[model samples]
Target chain A: MEFSSKLLEKAVNEMAQLPGIGKRTALRLVLHLLKQPSEQTHYLSQALTTMRDDVKFCKNCHNISDVEVCEICSNTSRNHKIICVVEDIRDVMAIENTNQFKGIYHVLGGKISPIDGVGPSQLNISTLVSKVKMGVIDEIIFALSSTMEGDTTNFYVYKQLKEFNVKTSTIARGIAVGDELEYADEVTLGRSIVQRVPFEISLKNN
Target chain B: MEFSSKLLEKAVNEMAQLPGIGKRTALRLVLHLLKQPSEQTHYLSQALTTMRDDVKFCKNCHNISDVEVCEICSNTSRNHKIICVVEDIRDVMAIENTNQFKGIYHVLGGKISPIDGVGPSQLNISTLVSKVKMGVIDEIIFALSSTMEGDTTNFYVYKQLKEFNVKTSTIARGIAVGDELEYADEVTLGRSIVQRVPFEISLKNN
Candidate 1:
C-alpha cells in the first residue's frame, strides 16, 4: 500500500516483518499508534528495545530471566529434583498458568526440526544432559508438544540421560479435559484407551 | 500468563496494547522476536520511535508528510483547484492506488461522531473551509465512508463551503462493480434507479 510519508512507510515495513502481520495490518497498527499519545509509542519501543538488549537466560534451565537464575530455578519451594522439559518459554508459561506442575522447567528454545534447519546441537540439550548426569535430578518429565520434532527431541535427550540414574517420563497424551470422547481423534482416543490408568488414580483428581 | 522474566512480561504487555492484539498473540510475537537476531528488534523499535517522534503533517491538507507540504499537495501535475475531502490518510492512499483522481486531498482525520465524542472542532474542518474560501477552489468531492457519521460530517462541511463559489459533490452510491443486482439492498437499488446515468455515460467507462 502507498504511504504519504517515508517515516510512516518505514515503520509499517518494520511492523509487517513480524510473523502473521501483513502490510495492511501493520499500517492499521501504525496508524493507531499515530492517533494515540506519543508516550504510548515511546513506552512500547523502549520496552521492546530494553528487553531485547538486556534480557538474560537462566544459567541452569535456559529460560528467559532478568537475573542469572530464573525464579523457578532459584525458588526453594519448587521441586528441584524434577525438571519439566518444554519446547519454548510459551510452553512454560502455559504449564505454569495451570499451576499443576511444581517442578522447575528446562526450555529447549525449540524442538529438533531438521526441516527447519534446527538440530539437537542448536538446542540446550547438552546442559540438560549435564544436569541429569550431575545426579541432582531424580526425574525428567517431557512436556513438549506431541509432534514429530517434539518426539525426536525427547528421544535425543532421553538417550543422553539413559546412562544416568534419573527416571524419565512424558506428559500424558489424551483428549482435552472438557472435550467429548466422541469428538476425539481416533489415534488419540486409542492411545488414551490403551494407556488407561487404574480407576482409583483417575478418580483422585476429580 | 506468568513470565519467567519481568522484562519479557513488560515487552509483551506493551505489545498487546496495540489495537487487535491480545495477550496470547502478544506472547507469540515477543517469542518470535526473541528467536530472531537482536538487530531485527532494534530496527523495529527504532523505526516506530523515529516515525512517532519526527513525522509531520502537511500545512495545507493535514496529510502526513516529512516536509512542510505533502507530495500530492506540492505536485504541480495534480489539480489543486479540485480537492477530494477524505476522513484520513488511508483514503488518500486508496484513491492514489486506483490511479483515478489527479486532485489534491484534504484529510479531515476523522468524521463527526457524537457517540465517540468527536465533533467538528476536533477535526481539520476549519482549515478546509478556509482553503475553499480562498476563492481558487473549483470543486470539492466528498470521498468519506458511507456511514451516518460520514454523512453528517460531509453535510456539515458542505454547509461551511455553501457560501463560497466552489461546487460540491458526493461520490455515487450504488451496487458495487461486478455485484449481482438482485442481491443489492433495496435502498441502494432504489437510489441507483433514481440517479441512473445516461446510457452513453455509463457505457463510456466500460
Candidate 2:
C-alpha cells in the first residue's frame, strides 16, 4: 500500500517483518498506534527494546528469565534430578499449570527441524547433554509435542545421552479426557491400547 | 498466560494493546522477535518510536506528510479550485489509486461519531470551512463512506458551506461493478435505480 509519509512506511514495513503480520495488517497496526497517545507507542517501543537488551535465560534450563537462574531451577523443594525436556518456555508454563509434575525442566528452546534449517547444534542440546553427563539427574522425561520434529529432537537427545547411565521416558499419548474413543486418530488409539496401564494404577491417579 | 520474565511480559502486554491482538498472539510475536537477531527488534522499535515522535501532518489538507504542506497541495498541476473531502489519509490513498480524481483532498481525520465521542470540533472541518470562505474553491465533493457517521459529517460540512458559491456533491452510491443485481442489497439496488443516469453516461467512463 502507498503511504504518504516515509516514516509511516518504515514503521509499517518493520511491523510487517513479523511472522503472521502482512503489509496491510502492519499499516493498520501502525495507524492504530498513531491514533493512540504518544505514551502508548513509547511504552511499546521501550518494553521491546528493554526486553531485547536485558532479558536473560536460565543458565541451567535455557528458559527465559530475568535472573541468571530461573525460579524453578533454584527452587530446592522441586526434584531437579528428574528433568523434563520440552521445546520452549511456553511448554514449561503449560506443564507448570498442570501442577502434576514436581520435576524441573530442560528447555530445548526449539525442536530440530532440518526443513526449517534448524539442526541439533542450533538448539540448547549441548548444555543439556553436559547436564546429563554430570550424573546428578535420576530420570529424564520427554514432554515435547507429538509432531515429527518433536520425536526427532527427542531421539537425537536420547542418542546423545545413550552412553550415560540415565533412565529416559516420554509423556503418554492418549485421547483427551473429554474425547470419544471412536474419534481418536488410529496412531494415538493404537498407542494408547498398547501402552494401557493396570486398572488400579489408572484409578490411583484419579 | 504466565511469563517467566517480567521484561517479556511487559513487551507482550504492550504488543497486545494494539487493536485485534490478544495475549496469546502477542506472546507468539514477542517470542518470534526474540528468536530473530537483536537488530530486528532494534529496527522495529526504532522505526515505531521515530514515526510516533517525528511524523508530521500536512498543514493545508491535514493528510499525513513529511513536510509542512503535502505534495498534492503543493503541486501546481492538480486543480486548486476543486476539493474532495475524505475521512482519513487511507481514503486519500484509495482515491489516488483510482487515478480518476485530479482535485486536491481535505482529510477530516475522522467522521462525526458521537458514540465514539468524536465531534466536528475535534476534526479538521473548521480549516476546510475557512478555506471555503476564502472563495478560492469552485466545487466541493463529499467522498466519505455511506455510513451514518459519514453522512452526518457530510451534512454538517454541507450546512457549513451552504452560503458559499461553490457547488457541493457527493460520491455516487450504486451497485458495485461485477455485482449481480439480484444479490445486491435492497437499499443499494433501490438507490441505483432511482439515481440511474443516461445510458451513454455509463458507457463514457468505460
Which is the leading candidate under TM-score?
Answer: 1
State the fnat of model 1: 0.92
Candidate 1 lDDT for residue A114: 86
C-alpha lDDT (0 to 100) for residue A74 of candidate 1: 96
Candidate 2 residue lDDT tens string, A1-206: 77889999999999999989998889889989989999999999999999998999999999999999998999999998999999998899999998899989999999999899999988999998899899998999999999999999999999999899799999999978889998999999999999999999999877
Clashes of 1: 0
Docking class of 2: high
Alpha-carbon deviation at B86 in model 1, angstroms: 0.6
lDDT for B9 in candidate 1 is 93
Model 1 residue B78 CA deviation (Å) reads 1.4
- Misplaced by over 4 Å in model 2 are A180-186, A193-206, B180-183
> Which 10 residues in a row give candidate 2 chain A its minimum summed lDDT?
A174-183
What total of clashing residue pairs does each candidate reach? Answer: 0, 0
How far off is residue A20 in model 2, in Å?
1.1
- Native interface contact recovery, all models: 0.92, 0.90
